[model samples]
Target: MSSPEQRAAAILASQRFVVIGTTDADGPWTAAAQYRLRPRGLYVESDLGSRHARAIAVSGTASGVVYDSSAAVADADGVQLAFSAREVDATEPAVRAILASRLPRDAGPVAELDDEVAAVLAVPTKRLYVLEVERAYVFDRDAWRSRGTDARIEIEAADVWAALGRP
Candidate 1:
């Protein structure tokens, strides 16, 4: 059987999008954004004016879920994350590297990718955000089987990174 860390890593790596939840003075908000996963965190692109983005900017915190929507109810599995989030400058080397890694092999040269990223970030409203995960949990099927009730098991962030073959 797969460990919780393995399950979380699989779900995170395979999922293309995450529904991020954030809060502001008015109330809570959720928005889905396509994501690229790295050992450090999950990266997403959004507009600075977006509700979720604005909320993150204010609170510096967010929670998100990544799951297979196509899965049957009985077989459903997902990762729940609590994170510190912030807008990152696209010109930063780390940001550029993350963006470049997500591109297809044939997408083009590194310089071209940097140009594209720059063009997008140049829009006053657009920004790149990173969610640095603090805590994570995965659905525990073994617990469900044993107790006949849904349950989640906390997986260490280090374990999740290790599962991804990172230090």
Candidate 2:
């Protein structure tokens, strides 16, 4: 049987999509996002006008989960994470490099997105947000009558990104 820590590392490495839940004046909101896993946490790129970005700008907090959709019920596993999001300053060379790595499918190359063209298209400059994971939990799929999962493990990797080197 695989340990939960191993399950979490696999999830973080393999999953590309996550649903982030946030709060607004009305109530709770959720956004489906494409994310990249880094030792720093989950790195997600979004434009400023996106509701996801707006919400993060307002609250700087969110929660999300990632899992493999193709797995069978008995074999399924996932990671639940609570995190905070902060905008990355694109002017910094290191930060811009990260942003460049997440180019939009609809957009042309970075050089083509000059300020003039970008402004006319309402293409808000890509903003990098790191989901600074606060709490991470690993679980498996089970029957309704059972405890949510047989082996619940709290992933403490968020403290120092130790999960990155899980062996």
Candidate 3:
């Protein structure tokens, strides 16, 4: 992990829904997506047949906002990332391990997915996608810290991780 990666993970842990923005020839589109953080990217499991899924597949590029909305003031802490997204090999060891670990925690949307498929409709076609950032900026109250995919910021990722660990 790196500083940007650390910041990204913190943002993910602190927030549940991400605003996903994409564009097509006719116009721009956006949707709120539930996500989980991975070492190198973020994961979103969505209906395979939906427009949200189709947009990501067609463009591969996306920008997302993850914000801690419980601020005392009008507008506050958040992070925004520009990234690429694609369906992942769910069986890949790393991906599998990460998903499994988060499952027990019942993190956000993962909880809904863990339900018995005993729903009105048959189990839907849902696939996990990896959203890897090309660049990102973190807004901590009033200040901003930014880094490219290279994480040109000087901080070590490990330090950031340790500091942000949940008490």
Candidate 4:
């Protein structure tokens, strides 16, 4: 049987997008965005003026889930994460690395990558956001079976990263 960390890694690796939950004075909101996973957490790109981004700016925190929508209820699995979110400068090396990784091999040479990153950064409204996960959880099937109730088990972020083959 796979460990919780392995299960979480599989779920995260199989998904391209995460549904992020946030809130403001108005109330709670959720939005789905494409993500790039990193050892520390994940990165998402969005407009700085977006509701989610604005909420993150105010609260500095968010929670999200990544799961397979097509899975049967009995076979369902996913990773739930609580995060400290912040807007990261696009010029930062890690941000640039994320941008570069998004480029296709056929896209062009190094110069083109530079141009692409520059163009993206040129847009004042667009920003790169980092969600530094504070806590992570996965469904505890053993507990569910034993207790006849659904539950989640917390796992270390490092374990998830290791399972995903990251340092």
Error of 2 at 117 (Å): 17
lDDT of 2 by residue, 76-110 (tens): 77788888788776555546445444313222467
- How far out, in Å, is residue 125 in model 3? 2.1
lDDT of 4 by residue, 9-36 (tens): 8888878899999999999999999987
Q: Which ten residues in a row have the lowest lDDT in candidate 1?
A: 99-108
Clashing pairs in 2: none
TM-score of each: 0.85, 0.72, 0.62, 0.84
Q: lDDT per model, in order?
A: 0.80, 0.68, 0.60, 0.82
RMSD after Cα superposition, model 3: 6.9
- Candidate 3 residue pairs in clash (backbone atoms < 3 Å): none
| Pairs in clash, predicted candidate 4 | none
Report how far off residue 71 is in candidate 2 (Å).
0.9
All candidates in order of TM-score, best leading? 1, 4, 2, 3
Q: Model 1: how large is the Cα RMSD against the reference?
A: 2.9
Lowest lDDT 10-mer window, candidate 2? 99-108
Better candidate by TM-score, 2 or 4: 4
Give the Å error, residue 104, model 4. 13
Clashes of each: 0, 0, 0, 0
User: What value does the lDDT take at residue 84 in candidate 1?
Assistant: 95
Cα RMSD (angstroms) for every candidate in the order listed: 2.9, 5.7, 6.9, 3.4
Which rank order by lDDT, best down to worst?
A: 4, 1, 2, 3
Which scores higher on lDDT, 1 or 2?
1
